[model samples]
Target chain A: MARTVIYERVALIGLGLIAGSMGLRMKRDGLAGEVVGTARSAKTRDMAVGLGLCDRVTDTAAEAVQDADLVVLCVPVGAMEDVAREIGPHLKPGATVSDVGSVKRAVAEAIGPHLPDGVDFIPAHPLAGTEHSGPESGFPELFDNRWCLLTPVTDSPDAVERLTRFWRAMGSNVETMDADHHDLVLAVTSHAPHLIAYTMVGVADDLRRVTDSEVIKYSAAGFRDFTRIAASDPVMWRDVFLNNKDATLEILGRFTEELFSLQRAIRKGDGEMLHEYFTRTRAIRRGVIEAGQDTDKPDFGRGTKP
Target chain B: MARTVIYERVALIGLGLIAGSMGLRMKRDGLAGEVVGTARSAKTRDMAVGLGLCDRVTDTAAEAVQDADLVVLCVPVGAMEDVAREIGPHLKPGATVSDVGSVKRAVAEAIGPHLPDGVDFIPAHPLAGTEHSGPESGFPELFDNRWCLLTPVTDSPDAVERLTRFWRAMGSNVETMDADHHDLVLAVTSHAPHLIAYTMVGVADDLRRVTDSEVIKYSAAGFRDFTRIAASDPVMWRDVFLNNKDATLEILGRFTEELFSLQRAIRKGDGEMLHEYFTRTRAIRRGVIEAGQDTDKPDFGRGTKP
Candidate 1:
């Protein structure tokens, strides 16, 4: 997993779920020569220091990225550009800067112009997470059995290989795709689904006739699933929707059309149509389980056992 | 658990998730003198036999209930009336008859009328299950943290007490409620949530561009939860929806109205409204986890040992 000890120092600006996992894994596998992390909140810096998630914790992005050979931004999508600008002057010459945002194209557009000429901007998106947020919520095994899609701005083979090795050491299977393709795939697989969950949870919340007690008691059935999604960090999801608006809206449009059709099946008492639609989705669930995207045992999101 | 040994023989008339779990617990705790089970399908009978979920798996409803001191009908709400008609003559005088239906009032109305006058009709609904059905889906722990509400029309205190003991032995906390109330509570919490999941999954299934591969690939975002619910045994859910139509329709009407309001929020770019609603639902999720109705873990249907 040392992967040739590529980077001298890896800077992580914003130690939330993804960065925290990266820090823990870097420590566990010695993937980084030195791990430097920073957070806006003093509380988070203290926690990162106490957890030994990094070799250094700093108040500003400049301090975190100074002299680092690789810099990975793990902040909310909305904050990427600002963080990039803050670290632009301090970044090492010929350093590779990447991110773990849900939307890659927007990230590249937002952060690409800020990096110095010699520094490389290689945007990456890791398709993994739990609803929990902040440093303490992350575990070393969070990236295990998950996909880490790299959307490189420039075809820097050396940069790509180095970053790939870094993520591989962190326990993620790596894939390279274009920025827009990454966004489109995410819009279908993650963005639209999250929006729908947020929508459903909002809907259930509006149902005042059903007391909170009743909804809580019977969540085991299905509503709990939506809650799990809606419970996702608000700023992260909000940024994803806003940044990936076009693709998300496209998927949502398709989703609404399909929903209306199903609505008709229910209204028409067409059990056959309903059953047929339901039967088709099972194959997708099976495919996911077989593809190792999901597990047969119910995932409670307590962090997978090592 | 021998708490008066309510019945010498407890005959479970359907060896599926609920009934199989009941048989497992009763045998595990020695709550009944003997545990018997019945299934219409020979394949199911064989599976139940292989699982050792019952001492005997009879094919006939009449033969299954004969000489049984306690008779539990664990079948679809749609089949309860016909099953009652089929097993009425075989029930011993003064023996108790209970069921594990989602809509208890309708079950009481449909099945209670068909029971013999001497047979005590005590309708019960267990608030527990996995998306999986059939005898193989059950485990002794399925009912460990769930509630089993009994709706008894009979004024026989002794009969109600006896059934309570049986459920306690099955690892359930029993709550005695009227049939109509049980239907209303479940409609809000369980049935409506299920319908929404089914509807969402159906919506995803109809999305032509979001290939099945993509859905499976990015299922962790949120869609997978609905897939699990929508993947549930269709016939059982079909029966649930058809039998509990009034309650289902009522809750669904409320849900649709709420959903429309949220859609308007999204369409109008009402971020405050969206944030406010999303924030409130988090409280309900907290309550559900505290109630132990759901695990606080993220991605419930995704992986093992998380």
Candidate 2:
């Protein structure tokens, strides 16, 4: 049986939305003994302190993890390895190291080699967020009931269980899977959908005859939904795209092929094909509702055209 | 000056979400002297009567419109002309016939010739609806703070003004514009957005590599928003697609060209292009929020994802 433990000292190596939320949650729940956070900029460190995101804030990654029992690398996926290396020598022996990056496979490979043998390296993703980002954008309830999936290496039961229990203590249901599986699942569920929304917004913006003002003015019927998702943090998403290149590209390839077929049907005025396609798509939405992932209501949180 | 003449023995044709909502609003505000509604099916007519959607309900359009001062056509855009043709001879002289169809030009053009010379025809779109359909789905607050656009061609100013007042009484902002303009605006804001959402869902469904279970799960990031929009009344949307073909196609043409360019940039691994396009789209969402068209808060009505 795994022993129950509250982290004596936790170091969060980023000060953005996810890290801020996790900090707030840890503080509110008293899940960690001491919460220390670091950012690349002194300005960010100051803001994190002002926001009370952690008990201590600093600019140096090594200093933040110097005496920490748990070190979480919540920076961008591309920066995970660099952060890991910077803090590698400073992390206490037998310390638990994890991340909150969206892409799992690359991050696992990138940061895995940087960790000392005594330190644990686990990759995790909290499937919770808003379109907004940064320390100010996060709320305490951001991860209250969301799924937190961990993609850990083989023969890592003890470290995986410890992280799982930690997330559960922070109000998340935990699941463990391989990094590639996590990447593929997220590509379909998160990455492809965001890309599609971003692409659609790009498409609307390209409308020469249809003025952008008109699009903005009348975004009620459906496009507003696309805009909400497209408005998500650019840097986070850009990093996500670049890091999860293989999985995203694979899903995107499939998407484009299907989209081409749809385009042909529309071009040929094949209403039957169009109708059938729409009908099939409708069932998937019902499944989403059934899976408790979506609401049947219009606009989700948005009220009707008022 | 606009007259205060109420619709005497008003006929509400094709009782569904819009017509039922109108009925409830009329009852709450006493907008009409009398309301007699008809439905194609006996069951729907009975539901309208049972829901108190009208003062009276009838199976036949002729019976419903008999001696009515105003007839509001609430059928789907595809069924508008047929309903108009069927009810044309029965409409009394000086009676104004209007509709709440989303598509304006074709609906107006199709129903215009069928009306008697002295009978007025106005095409109106009350920019409103929930995903739920049928008379039971309506409530008095449906039109509250909503927009009701009137596209009239040489109709009696007195009659148009009275209709405008009726919608105002139902708690809507009234605007008068040409049918073409209304269609063009809706095409950008509503029609193309719905189409793209439908297309995205279709793409997801066709992807053999992306399992349905995974798509349904982990959707909170963005895909869930598209699903909600995609869950709108399929038949109503089908009719909308048919009626507003030209403007939708034109906007779609522009959308496709833009999407192709974005796809090319993505394939070339150009992060700047991706970020620039995404960054620009955010301003429109801000504009929408400023316009009070959307809420900045996450649809809290949805509550925390469980």
Q: Tell me how each candidate scores on DockQ against the true complex.
A: 0.48, 0.49
In terms of lDDT, the poorest run of 10 residues in model 2 chain B is B297-306
Q: Cα miss at B35, model 1 (Å)?
A: 1.9
C-alpha RMSD for every candidate: 2.8, 3.7
Model 1 global lDDT (CA atoms, 0 to 1) = 0.77
Query: Once superposed on the true structure, which residue ranges of model 1 sit more than 4 Å away at CA?
Result: A1-4, A208-212, A300-302, B1-4, B206-212, B260-269, B297-306
- The candidate that achieves the highest TM-score relative to the unseen native structure: 1
On residues B103-164, what C-alpha lDDT tens digit does candidate 1 reach at each position?
88778989877888888889998877876778877777777767888999888999999898
Could you tell me the lDDT of residue A125 within candidate 2? 94
Question: For candidate 2, lDDT tens digit of each residue in B1-306?
Answer: 233436767899999988988898777667777889999899998888898879988788878889998898998787888888889999999888899999899888989988888887778888777666788888887776667889986548988898888788777778898899889888877887788777767666655354546666666667677776777777777777777777887777777667667656667778888777778877656776776556677652211211
Per-residue lDDT over A68-172 for candidate 2, one digit per residue giving the tens place of the 0 to 100 score: 988999898878889988988887888888899999988988888887878877789998877677887766667766789888763668877878888997777
Q: For chain B alone, what TM-score does every candidate structure achieve against the true structure? A: 0.93, 0.93
In candidate 1, what are the lDDT values of residues A13-118, reduced to their tens digit? 9999889888898887777789989999999999998888899898999999988999999999989999998999998889999999999888999999998788
